[model samples]
Target: MNITKTDVLWNYAATFFKISSSVLLLPIILHKLPSEDVGIWSVFSSIAALVFLIDFGFNSSFSRNVTYVFSGVNSLLTNGHDTSAQSGGVNYSLLKGLLSSMRWFYSRVSLTLFLLLLTLGTFYISRLLNEYHGNKTNVYIAWGLFIAINTYNLYTLYYDALLEGKGLIRVSKQITILGHLAYLLVSTVAIYLGFGLIALVLAQLISIIIIRTISQRKFFNADIIYQLQNCEGDDKKDVLKAIYPNAVKYGITSLGGFMIQKSSIFIGSLYLSLSAIASFGITKQMMDITVSIANIAVATFLPQIANLRIGGNYDRIKAICIRGVVIANLIFITGAATIIFLGTPILHLIKSNTNLNQQVLLVVAFSSLIGLNSGISGAIISTKNHIPFVKPSILSGVATILLLIVFFKFTNLGLLGMAMAPGLIDLCYQGWKWPLVVIKELNIKFSDFKMVIMKTDKPA
Candidate 1:
């Protein structure tokens, strides 16, 4: 499962298509939906992000463990992995247990999520709709579809972990590209046909179906199916127990992450006008795009890093980290620069009512630079099956929220306050601490980092 150059290119292509579809879809969305509808959509998007919180980090834990199983590790561990126990052969018994555990876990979780969204989510959306001046019927219709799609997507989420854990980067990314294409084409046609918000949700439903179906076929090819069928019995409970500790930690960290990145919109909706939320949402969306593109290098190598970790290949991991960090920074800088310089004019060109606030965008760009690198560093640390930054991440999110409350209560900063709060909090801790920890852990020197920046190539 060595990562090939083609794999790298497809990874980039996948991200490109995913982001570009969103970018290309924006003008259409802006034209079709009013600013109020756009603002509502932003809330919907933020709420949808709660799936990450609901997942409680099981996806990453599952994916990392899947990598371990495929890497020939004989047993699972609650904390740290056992590199020395490698058997140099695939453990189909372990794989089968994990697959069973994943299905059992997601089935229950997905049902719970569906119920949560239906009750708590509907209550929240009802509040938003009560103040709405648009057609509430359309929004309600869209909301139902949103719940259905998210629940279905979460149920089939393991396909992603399965593909990436197998180091099928190229295949996984190809599926993403196809999914995004389906979303783009369907949404465009549906919107043009006057479907409005329902169009967006319907398109997403179609895309998720395509992605999951393709991923199932690709990962469960005849050879794998046969192997799995013939494997000895395994204890799903044991596998889950081994995964629970780190999975819980990762869940807490994700909660912190959600608070830091998304709480702003939710809070802003209470304090600011709908137009303000729309502006901030658009800027945040662009920054998210930049971050995702920046993350390509590191994201592509995650399973490989996990495999190398089992083999005690620190030097190789260091090289990937250095190169990944460097590439990520470069992409973020370029993308942020593009958004800062041209984002507003482009909005105007699209005749978009929701304009990006340049001041907020600039601040967010700087903060995002810190955030993306910290994420890369965090990923590096997680390969060793530990998550020490859980406390720091959670603390940062808390501090950011408190500061946001203070700023909004007594200051005139408005959207700038929303942008500045998380940046300042993260800069104090997560922004710098994680990278330093990675450098120390990997024994990376300033000179080595600089050298990697100058000559970024795959390590031997």
Candidate 2:
């Protein structure tokens, strides 16, 4: 098969593997671990995502610029280049510089994250451990391992940036599936053997190692290696200087998004019981799978979108955007219904200690719909290479977190508060605001949106 078709199939296949693994693992963990421990694990997982906030969007910004270099561009810009600027062969010097810069930046950030995780992260976990029934020492040991694994994983962000930038989505996804397979096998065995929370972290560490080793071997092939080595790279500082402005904007956007989507778990843990946190976490996780599924089309087409935008084909961009939105909404609707209808029964069948309430599930479902729609808009907007919604996006997330904090503090709404706060806040700003902004930017009319629903024009 050709590259695009290969990537599309592997992308869907990767998502299928992920959804399967997530569904399969829940039963083992929920049955093996106590409710409180499950909650603690869920909270830790949420907070660990905070490490991305430290990334400052450097990886993505760097990768996008990598695509430019590969497209024969000599210099980088905050936004993408014009179609007329497209020229000949890859600029090895720029590619070399970007790789060096990515490594240097990630090296420093990885160490900083390790320190923070060892110190502040450990302290946060300690607080959660106060009323827990599990062995404290085991959790601490797992925490140490987790910090080390994540630190090393963060250091290898360049591997992923390069692979995805080169549009090696099929290989990249295949590598990811292999790693997740290892994760499933190890975690399943560990949980079955009664390793508790430690098993999950251990499995993750194993998965990362497998993924990075394979990804590095694949991305840095003989030809790429010769090219990079032969080229005299520009100074890393120069490359960073060219990319930092947009990268920082992306970082702020990342932070704001985390605040909106994940801060609820962090704040909610303080007010609700650990069991409640676990329930909310599971429900949210299931919906997150739906969100991931919904995003497949846009994510798969990102590199193509970049090329199309640079070629000044706004019509194709519009067509792709409409189709992606439709697919995303349909995925979210179908996945949400299944989770709402079969979720509890499935848990019961597996003898899981935890359950998702229908009300919380409904709220979570609605939020996923909006979040997925907004995400589609954001991904489309990103292809333009300008991050116009950075401020507004961050503001929406910050507002959501603040509202969640207030809800937790003043009211006794408990777990429901955690699920509902972001939904309410996001709908007011990011949920609708981003799509509106996207439509305006694309010059898409309401009637155009309606008409495109049936148009079935594949992105050129």
Candidate 3:
């Protein structure tokens, strides 16, 4: 098979393997830990995600720059340029220059920002822990694990940016699979030894650190380092300045997304019972696993789309966007059907409780529908650099929160209501608005876009 097809297959296979491992292991964890502890773990996970918001869009901004640089280098080589010549190597030098400057800037700005947020999150979590369980040690351990996980995440994002920019999805997949395997082993051992939540968190962090170290050595060797080192100061500064706006924009957008996804749990904890939070958390985790399959496809296509834009290839960009939407839809339909049919059995295998099963299935079904629709439009928005869409995205998130509050006050739908509220809003707003934005801003014919969806490529 050709390289592109191989990469696509690798990504899908890798995502499935990693997510499957997590799913398999999670039930064992839920069984081992008390339900209350499981609920707390869920809260910690969400808080850790919030820690990443401190990233200030650095990763997204860097990925776009990296992709642009890689594409420029490829274009030069494809056009029969002698890359070894001084001027031929100019673009590489320029890219490295920019990367180095941005890395320095990010290291300084992000470190301070992350530390501040970590402090705030730690204090907030501490208060919640005191109010809920009065367990200080677990809270401290949770914070420790959260820090390790977030730090490792920052490193992994850098590696991922490089891998995706270079179109090395297969290598990326290998790294991910290895990381997940390590986590599975650690989680299993921890459970067997009765180590509780700390074990799980530590295992996850160690797995990421090891995988990132190995991948960095394997894929990003001395040549890339040398390129960065040789970059001129002026060129480096220029790139950093150019990407600053994009980085901030992405950072703001990401915060909105984080709030939408995690706020439900936080709000549920405040307004509903802990058991309700656990039930809802389980459903959300399952939906995340299902959507991750589509995410692999989106990640693979994003760099390509960015490159197409940089190269002024609008037709191919639109075609890829539409095709991506179709693929996402099919995957979602398959996932939703399976969940609707077998969700109870799956939940039984994970948790022996019928109530949990019913609640999880309900949330997963709604989430699947919303995820499928949003995935396509989200891809297009990201590729089109329509950062302004973030305003509406935030609005959708706010609306979700408001609706959840109202539903909780007026209705007895409980956790299911909380889970479905956001999905309902996103399905109505993002699903409709993004397509219209794509058509209006990008000036692509809706019919042609639809044609790309109807056409099929070989399955990944």
Off by over 4 Å in 1: 456-460
lDDT assessment of candidate 1: 0.89
lDDT of each: 0.89, 0.83, 0.67
Worst 10 residues of 2 by lDDT: 77-86
- Using lDDT, give the best candidate's number: 1
Model 3 Cα shift for residue 145 (angstroms): 2.2
Error in Å for residue 76 of model 1: 0.7
Which candidate wins on TM-score?
A: 1
Candidate 2's clash total is: 0
Per-residue lDDT tens digits for candidate 1, residues 65-177, read 98998888888998878666677788899999999999999999999999999999899889877667888999999999999999999999989999999998999999999
TM-score of 1: 0.97
RMSD (Cα, Å) for all candidates, in order, is 1.4, 1.9, 4.7
- Residues 90-126, model 3: lDDT tens digits: 3666566655765676566546645764787677666
Candidate 2 is scored at a TM of 0.96
